[model samples]
Target: MGLNKITGILPHENTCADLVPMAYFYDVLKNIQKVEEDIINMTYEDGRQPLLVHLDMLLTIARKYPNTAAMCIYELKRKHLKDTFEAWWERNQKKIPKKYRTGIRQNADELFDELFAIKSWAKSE
Candidate 1:
């Protein structure tokens, strides 16, 4: 299904718009269950990766936007659902994602450093 546009969409600090990528991920999960091989073989027009677009992009979206919505309560629901998905997928024969050194990296370095004060010494000196 080549890139197309249709949204049954949400919002906002004065209409601040956003898209929950995890929604796409939920659809992908359904497809994975229905046709695991087909989902695994799928590709995107944009480019390629070690895994299928669904595995890489949609799964990454699952990580990035884990929650179905922006509210705190929704995050809790997402955590539970994600945990369930992980347990279910673990039983499948298909291989899980592999992270080579060249694979996509999370934009989490500064957050981790700030959380652990990894660079706090620099500030004092």
Candidate 2:
């Protein structure tokens, strides 16, 4: 029923071993925006939400391309989904295989740290 329950059931990173290119992920993120908008505008009959689906996509992406997954987080933050993204990350980080978590954490820290610093600095101006 809840987002956690829905996303908790999805496949883990280890299960997604296919190599996904960065461009493919970029395209997927672009297309997901439309679905996200629709989900935001109307109530879903099946109780599913865009964020839940997006989280699954992100996990798959992270499995193949952790750096690209970091970019997806940037995209989510750009779309004002920071809180949701953070919650999703917290909920699913443990579900990701331990082997992949190091790369994911490194990529996320490298990408988001600078971005967040700049955002904070801009807000102060």
Candidate 3:
């Protein structure tokens, strides 16, 4: 199949708002699954170091679709993805480059705060 045909099966820009609920459900689940797979495949001596590439991917997603990112975070917490991530962080924190560690932790804390705020607002509505 052509690239266009492949992209056609995915949700379109116009339908994204309507797909928010599904995005919330599936995005977090998929991330969790992918992270688990990465952990299993890791062969590093210090264990699976946190994937800065994954973090960068998330930042790109957040920039392009802020609402979807919020929804995904909401689902992540609801589905216990946060716990999984925390466990991963604990396993890999020490292995992260010292220069990048502080910034990564700050960004992660900010993301958690933003997600929690979004979920709280949603519940109050």
Per-model tally of clashing residue pairs: 0, 0, 0
lDDT of 3: 0.54
In model 1, what are the clashing residue pairs, if there are any?
none
In model 3, what lDDT does residue 12 have?
45
Report each candidate's C-alpha RMSD, comma-separated, in the order given. 14.4, 16.5, 7.9
| Candidate 2 worst ten-residue window by lDDT | 116-125
Whole-model lDDT for model 2 versus the true structure? 0.50
Give the CA lDDT, 0 to 100, for residue 115 in model 2: 36
What pairs collide in candidate 3? none
How accurate locally is residue 58 in candidate 3, as Cα lDDT from 0 to 100? Answer: 55
- What lDDT does the true structure give each of the candidates? 0.34, 0.50, 0.54
**Of 2 and 3, the candidate ranking higher by TM-score:** 3
- What is candidate 2's lDDT per residue for 26-74, written digit by digit as tens? 7666756665555445433333335545545655665555655554445
Clashing pairs in 2: none
Estimate TM-scores for all models: 0.27, 0.40, 0.47
